[model samples]
Target: MHLPEIRRSHIAIAVISGLLFSLSFRLNQYFDALFVYSAGISLLFLPAGVKLLAVLVGRLPAIVGIMVVSVHLGASIWPDKPMTAIVYFAFVSLMTYPIATLGVMRLFHIRKNLSNLRYHHIVVLSVVASILNGLVHNWLYLAQGVTTSEELWHKSAAMALGDFMGCFVVVAFFHAAMGVLRSARNPQID
Candidate 1:
């Protein structure tokens, strides 16, 4: 219900989802077993680190987005299969990161005080983070000889769409979670 409680719930959900997804991939042979294992590790640790940094820096959402992007970048560079690496990075940065960051932001009502200037700032930060995330993944794939310029452009477009979709899902989840928490915290009033 409170900020701390909400944070815990988010972390728990993220962890559970990450684990379930990784296990599913492993079971279905969607990825290399090692890759799926590594992804699971990253999902558990990277977001937690990002959230801590964000909280300490007092720019929670933006910093979390950046760190999530950084995680994707690192993952992209570590894989032998460039396409797989790029896809993984895209999923995490463009899909998971945006959703998680937006969820936390909306849950806390962080945009309540936004003026046009502040709104612009938030949008700019999110866009920058998303672009940087896509570029990093694309660059990795290019460096690994996995994709040409045309393919890179296509992937970039997909990355952008993933980011938008992620943001939408995360924001919606935040709203739902916040409502649930609010009700739990104030059952008598409700």
Candidate 2:
């Protein structure tokens, strides 16, 4: 595709991904830690073939917008800490995927295939995203004074394990769904 076409496609992907992220987050925030899975699934599955830059550019605004809306929606939930919750959500959202991608790139040596949504790329991404999602989030919680040093290591590890497991579950479902959908559209190719 030409530059203009690629730009539009990237924007469209971001917007759609953001919408999906916000919707998932909004509907499931009450679940607390479960939001990690929703987040992993939302952020990873949508922009598979898009470059990381495009995903960031597209989803950041949508996520921020969702965060802003949450300030109002969550006012009733955390009457005293709505802003805190909003800011935490925004910060975690900002930190999770980029850090995860970086970890995958460095650890998996898959930097060259970032633009392609191959199986290995998805696996590495899901693993990295899950691990970082837990670390960044629990570290934030620790910073916020929710956990003391005594529990930091174990707590973070447990959360990371949960996030990774949840990511794989969602990944399996989405991967299978994508295969079915693609096969339906391209029966001859499949």
Candidate 3:
């Protein structure tokens, strides 16, 4: 996109999402669990704001880059083991973002109209994204050295389920964010 147009919006969304996720981080000692849960919400809700900014600026690449870098940095500094966190970020970006983007685009016939995707489409996208997210977690576990194929599969399944749950949370958050954005964009007679 135009870069300039969306830069402000992207920054705003990133800041807000980062703050919200940080709040989640403080809520529990099981930092990984809390981060993953917050991540799902962040992915679903945050992307739209990013997309909005991208469209305005015509700087999709910058938006994506910012997201990847932010997530990577977050993972690098997370309380959990650094390696595991990096793996999680990689999976979320590589696998999750693509799958969710595809599933939602296909389901809604979105045609890349990122600015106006329906809420349901966003939810579907988030679900797919979450599934990919879980896969990444499982992959990380395996990379640490899986003893058996069955163990690998088991971890994979568990990660998938966790991703799905996280996706759902993200979808809910996305809808709320969309509503707020819509209201702000169209304040009317009351």
Candidate 4:
């Protein structure tokens, strides 16, 4: 099977995204500890938002970066875990953004340029992505006997909420930062 081409720019994006993911994840773990409800459940997962932004901008290459980092992180965090389990987790995490983005694209008929993208499109994407990530991860947990049925729905809901909020906060901050930069570059006539 033919693989997607990976150019220098893609590599650059991947490295940058991977670094950002690492930073965001560590920060989230350190500062959002109080918000953590369970092993994979948190109230404000900043990395989720960072992941979304990287996927949006870097596309497939970014996914590759995320995959690499996820595997690395998983392996490092669970050093005793088997290689197979770590790979599995990475695969599952890697699938979330692409599926959500493709689904949103097809559902909304958005162009590659995203010329028609709007605020609602982002909202829809964030919601769908968060739900998919939460549900898929929780289902895996249940299947692995890590979580019981009684805890599944609530855990999924909490994870989804965290993912959505993370995406919202990161996007909002990026937008505001861009606005400030623009204003600084071009001061309004008094």
Off by over 4 Å in 4: 1-6, 176-190
Off by over 4 Å in 3: 1-6, 17-22, 25-95, 111-123, 146-148, 176-190
Query: Rank order by TM-score, top first?
Result: 4, 2, 3, 1
Write out the backbone clash pairs for model 3.
1-57, 1-58, 1-59, 1-60, 2-57, 2-58, 2-59, 3-57, 6-57
Error of 4 at 106 (Å): 2.5
- Model 1 residue runs over 4 Å out of place are 1-128, 187-190
Top-lDDT candidate index: 4
lDDT of 1 by residue, 14-71 (tens): 5544443333323434333322222222111223323322332233344444444544
How far residue 131's Cα lies from its native spot in candidate 2, in Å, is 1.5
TM-score of each: 0.40, 0.59, 0.53, 0.86
RMSD of each: 10.5, 6.7, 6.8, 3.7
- lDDT string for model 4 (63-116, tens) is 888889999998997788788988997799668978998989899997766657
Each model's lDDT comes to 0.44, 0.54, 0.50, 0.84
User: Residue 20 in candidate 4 has what lDDT?
Assistant: 92
In candidate 1, how many clashes are counted? Answer: 0
Model 1 poorest 10 in a row by lDDT:
36-45
